[model samples]
Target: MSTDLIFSDATKLAELIRTRAVSPVEVVQAHLDRIGAVNPKLNAIVTVAEGALEAARAAEAAVMAGVALGPLHGVPFSAKDSIDTAGVPTQRGSPIFKGRIPDTDATSVARLKGAGAILLAKTNLPEFSYSTETDNLLTGRANNPWNYDRTPGGSSGGESAAIAAGMSPLGLGTDLAISIRGPAANTGIIGLKATHGRVPMTGIWPRVPRRNWHVGPMARSVRDVAVAYSLLAGADGADGFSTTPLRFDTGVGSSPDQPLRVGWLVEPGFGLIDSEVAATVQKAAEALHGVGCVVEPVRIPALEQENALDIFWRLHRMEVKPAFAAVTAGHEDEMFTISKAMLGEPDTALVDFVRLEQAAERLRDGFAEYFQRYDALLCPVLPIPAHAHGLAEFVINGRTVPATHSLSATVPLNVTGLPGLSIRFGTSRDGLPIGVQLVSRWFAESTILYLASLLETASPVRDLHPDI
Candidate 1:
């Protein structure tokens, strides 16, 4: 019963709790037990919530009293360590901030708690949440649940690993580039990087390059992500970027009025992708086509002309380096590999910065033009499946590329502030998970999410879990 409870989806758990088939204490304790069992091997959850059981007891009382409940009432959720949690240690996986605790919750965390979800724990991440690998001096490293030697991707790698391992049914992860989606792909779970500014980033770290960062949900099912997004969306007033008025439809498990037009691409624009990953994307496109949606091979010329990966690195380096320098001023020796690497890189030239900014605008325009004819676009989430830990480079399609190349497909969405969803649709030759990315134009989360629900039903890898 405990095993089944830990593996249940967040929505199912909520329903079970509401119906009295299961109590909130049972749900929370099941997750705590799972974390106690698996977290030592994975190091995914750095700090378990202190008052989780107490919160669960209070929720049980509410249920017994027949009080109105929130959509996620009695469900247990986790958050990446970089996201602030009131009274919980949010060390950001760096020694510089060791033993640090925030007095307030991040907007994303607060919204989830507001929905009556208990905070289960805080997952691990790279130092300052900067790397594509989840490792730092403070928390050591997060191992993949599927294969201890492989990574779960980062900087939300630990969150993805926790969800995949059934330690938590839902989680909140922040994405700067590939942090949320790439990690989800690596773990064979689902993650949503909603339209930028749709969810407030208030109370999170490193506000510089604020336009690129996002907070979204990671879960085992699309419906949980959809419900969490509904609760997390809308302007918080405190975050200037989150000014999008509360007016969009969640559109989960529903179809548009007309047949949707979708496009899929894996080459020329997103760097060199593994054949297996590309084939999975092709299969997803075909699946959508099979469902009566008009799908075809397409390309966005801007991605080809202006490499999104290059533009992201050039612009973000200029914006984030100073922020890193400021925070690590007195704690230089405590800085980790990722923070050191960012600081050591040469500054972006003024001319290049201007050019890259314009190029980013062109990429947005390109997507805008494409969306005029297509409702959504499908692509690869990562160039390859999760690789062995601590590797500096990857060889894909017979070409060796820097580890940063993993950001090729994902950074473009961040650059344009567009919405993208990562869902597992296939498996790799090495028995690892492979996910395809679904993207939509700005503020069209409903389209991609609704379409994701359809793809979720058609996915060949449904209900698959890692044998932890």
Candidate 2:
């Protein structure tokens, strides 16, 4: 069935294309034939969108003319070539924006193509998205559909290796640190970031640290990041940090009925983790304390100083290195040697960016006074999991460090705009995967999608997969 409809899930391919049993041009030619059979061993979809199957054959001729569809109507996603998609080619994997095309779209891809989804491809990142791992020089290294020699984590590593190898069920990454919850916890899927301005960042791009810029969704189910976070949350008055007003719920009282109060954190006391990634994030806080929550272990002394990776490298060398000094002035030999060594370093003053924005407003007022007595916080999205490909050091557990200190647990939720996520609860003993995140507070992404749908129903790597 179109190769099992490339591992279904965008709420079951938008309920089989809203009951026509399927046919938005057979789900965009079964994800363009699962991106031409696994995107040549996981380079993870670099472009592929020229009129995506004629917009899935005009969304299967508007479902045989009955029209009225939307809620990912024809379902098929994928973004993160630094978003924007008007006429497709968002080459942010940069060769100085090689064939860069963008006339519009990217208010979360124009609200997931106005909720009926179907963008069909763009993925790949790291250049200008500025590395977590995915390569660049213009569309290269993405790998890790379980372990293509590791790493699928990056500046949204090709939208988490094209939604963990099914090519694309949903996507849209972009995070400032550990981009999209560390490649959706190194490709086991389900990422979210959601709260620094709850969505809108208009047409995106090297748009400076719009307060730790965000833009979320990346799925493999949490009901497709709750139907792409209810059409990518509110406020589109051009992202003045997306002016609040988002209130998401995702039905079933968004999960937590009570007895909650969760909060785990194995050694956030300065990096180097991985005792099997702190026992799989303490078995996802013992699977949310076997379903009634109240999980313990707290901590948070402003993320155990050692200047949490020097306050995200002094907010990326004083505000994301001056938005690439005018887009790499005179093309600096077509950029990306780590974006010409982060725009030929040296700059940080203005009183050291006002003492690193007053130590990032005291770690965002100490995680808003530790989420006022915790209701959500579990941790470890990356302190070592999918390492290897070109890494400049990062062993963990047996020490080793220095990979720009693996953004010390996702740059304190991009310096406390909070709302982290991640999910995928376990694997690793060389089986890869292993996630955790959660976080919350500050537009509580529906309480971290109701404790990640209760640790994805006590996860056992819920529905496993990766045999691409």
- Kindly report which residue stretches of model 1 are placed more than 4 angstroms away from their true locations once superposed: 249-257
Top lDDT: which candidate number?
1
Global CA lDDT computed for model 2: 0.81
Tens digits of per-residue lDDT, candidate 2, 285-333, equal 9878887778899888877743755766655766666677777778777
By summed lDDT, the worst window of 10 consecutive residues in model 1 runs over 248-257
Candidate 1 lDDT score at position 425: 95
| TM-score of model 1 (CA atoms) | 0.98
Residues 1-468 of candidate 1 have per-residue lDDT tens digits of 998998899999999999999999999999999999999999999999889999999999999999999999999999999999999998999998999999999999999999999998999999998899999999989999989999999999999999999999999999999999999999999999999999999989987668899999999999999999999999998999998865764333324557888889998789899999999999999999888888899988988998888888889888888888998998989999778978999988899899999999999999989988888899999999999998889899898988889999999999999999999999999999999999987888888888889889999999988887
Clashes of 1: 0
Pairs with backbone N, CA or C atoms under 3 Å apart (clashes), candidate 2: 124-158
